[model samples]
Target: MSVSKLLSRIVAHSSDRIDTCKCVASSLHDHTYGITSDPLTQFACILSALIHDADHVGVPNTQLVKEETETAKRYKGKSVAEQNSVVLSWEMLLRPEYCDLRGAIAATDAEWTRLKQLVVNSVMATDIMDKDLKGLRNVRWEKAFSEQDPSEDAHVTTNRKATIVIEHLIQASDVAHTMQHWHVYRKWNQRLFEEMYKAYKEGRSEKDPSEFWYKGETGFFDFYIIPLAKKLKDCGVFGVASDEYLTYAIQNRREWEERGEAVVDEMIEKVKAVWEEEAETTDTFVDEASVSL
Candidate 1:
């Protein structure tokens, strides 16, 4: 099968909360299909979305390398998570069970090469490994949007536009929760907090993550989420989705400023309750299993 289809199957079997693939794919559908009808571009976007977080370990790359996990060693501490996601997903796609799907997506050698490169580049762009990502994006944006003449639109190469748009689309969708309605944003935020809190408890991260969760979210919205939403609108290919996202981002930031701390406390409490419940349930299962033994 193609990587995207295989990923969809895996996600469906494994539950949706494991990653952000569905959200990114839906956002791409919202942003790209209407703008460009090219099959390859659409396929590339879908594949990138599915594989971007293919095997996330609920911890950051920094922690992965610090712990010297297998993934870190495999990628040599360079974008460990992103590289693993791409490599593992690509391997699964090439397996014999999915050969038919692979053939469907890549009928020619050149087509296969292009598809692999697009998937790799698009997935790698989401790593955010350092401060250079923003600088590189700025340069790409300038090159893509600096045209003054109406006729110049036609001169823009398909490869250039597809690559830029796919990268931006994934970036925007990766954080789409930040620009969504307050309830939606809270749901995902709490999920993320729980993930980080789990890591903190396991000694994979520094300090208790809950202490700075609210403030960190506010800073993220101010510095990254809003600018990304604006950039999506500025790209001029996504129509009003970016504007709607921007509006929600501003409103959400305001909401967070007004009462975010209280919400964080509530989220922390909720997560604690859930974890305790799970622990109790596991203990009960173990007791029963032991009795049966």
Candidate 2:
């Protein structure tokens, strides 16, 4: 079985949340990018999305930084969620059952580098608040497409201009829902908001008194979505269908904003409930361990 299949199994064993990740991955591969040719690459992409949040514990990198968690201290605030997830994925990939995918990914040094960088880029892009990431990626993307390289080899070169563009493509896919069909965008936006609020609860102890998980605003669509949608539409990588898709996404987001806070409130309540249960279980475990010791 491929790593993707194993991932599905792992997700089935863990939680249904993996279902959302799989759906997003399939959408990105089929609908958004239309690059379903390479099984290995597609599998890698799915793995990137699936493992990106493995053992996530619903905490934000910022909270990890504030708490000085081991992962935060190790990655030095560089997308700690992404870095840890990638490492965990690599570890799982090395197991005997997963060796097939590992060998496929590491077939050549070039292939290894490409897969590693792609996974890193896609996973790291989740942190939209990283000001430096946006600036650095934009600079690299501008330099890359401006040069107009036609070679496949040129496109995958590590730490090069083309690498940046490819990374942005993956990053673009991560948030592609914001620029997709309205029905699709609304569903995904709700799911994403749930993820964010879950992260908020996991990080609440690290937050200031006045802080909330998310403010339920459309600022993300207005700022990031609008500019990136325009850029993608102009670039033409997504083809003619995407033009309509982007239009619907923007329209739907506006509608969502006007629909009031019902959906957002539901998401917040669900996350808080889950975290409360988790906290109780954790406390029980700790008490048991202390008594045993």
Of the candidates shown, which would achieve the greatest TM-score relative to the real structure? 1
In candidate 1, stretches whose alpha carbon ends up further than 4 angstroms from where it belongs are 1-35, 146-158, 276-293
Deviation of model 1 at 228, angstroms: 0.3
**Candidate 2 lDDT over residue span 1-293, tens digit each:** 22232222221111223448667555434332333334545555676756767777566778788888899999998888878988987777778997686675678878877777677776776667788987877776675455555564633532354244344445556676766666676576666666665554545544421134134346667777776666655444344434654685678667767663665566556666876899999999999999999
Clashes of each: 1, 0
- Evaluated at residue 178, the lDDT of candidate 1 is 83
Write one digit per residue (lDDT tens) for candidate 1, span 1-293: 22232222211111223348666555444344332435765688788887799889999888899999988998898888999999999999989999899888978999989889888888888886545665786677676666444555443544455567678777766777888889998898888998999988777889787889888998999888898778766665554565787899999999999989999999889888987999999999999999999
lDDT (Cα atoms) of all candidates against the true structure = 0.75, 0.60
Residues forming the 10-long window of minimal summed lDDT in candidate 1: 5-14
For candidate 2, what is the TM-score?
0.64
| Global lDDT of model 2 | 0.60
Per-prediction TM-score, please?
0.79, 0.64
Weakest 10 consecutive residues of candidate 2 by summed lDDT: 6-15
